[model samples]
Target: MLAAYWRGEITLRKLRVLIQYLPEDSPARWQATDGRPFTIRDAMMWRALWSVATVAQQLAGKDKNAFENMPAYPWSKPLNQNTYGSFGDHTPEEVMDYLDSL
Candidate 1:
């Protein structure tokens, strides 16, 4: 999704809105990837991705994946694999702190 943003496939405003549309009944939850149910962790992962993508674009003044690594699990170490490796169980505050730390 961050790549989509960089590629002009989604607007920053839209991305920000998407990060919050994580209700349990929403498609973001119902249409979970890998046939798994979407959880807060997934929401957090996406929030970080879309956010960092915009940050990178602003810093670089151009489109780029950034591919920023986000910390997940144990919640104290950098996974170095973004949030994909996460079990998608982090709390909203935890995810926010991680992103702020970035």
Candidate 2:
């Protein structure tokens, strides 16, 4: 559902409802509300789900990476170099910027 929004197949209103269905602690839920801060667990779950959405979107001919193209989901952060290793160094800013630009 979120991936649908990223791909321009859905509206922000619909995305809001989809996000609202997540657990209360979900970063996506918080982010959809007001960009509130989130816990580490929230960040981890969001990233994992984003990765899955990215793959599914790609398979559907949406070249966008869910983590790199979608709206920020509250707990989004700059990847920690020491913790995330090679996958680190990216930031939600890049993704959010792309989305806004679109």
Per-prediction count of colliding residue pairs? 0, 0
Residue-level lDDT tens digits of model 2 in 1-102: 867888999999988877667676566645544657565677677778878877997788754444555545644443332343332245667656866999
TM-scores of the models, in the given order? 0.28, 0.33
What lDDT score goes with residue 11 in model 2?
99
Give the range where candidate 1 is weakest over 10 consecutive residues by summed lDDT: 66-75
Tell me the RMSD of model 2 versus the true structure.
19.1
Query: Which residue runs of candidate 1 sit more than 4 Å off their true CA positions?
Result: 1-36, 63-102
Tell me the deviation in Å of residue 3 in model 2. Answer: 46
Instruction: Give the top-scoring candidate (TM-score).
Output: 2
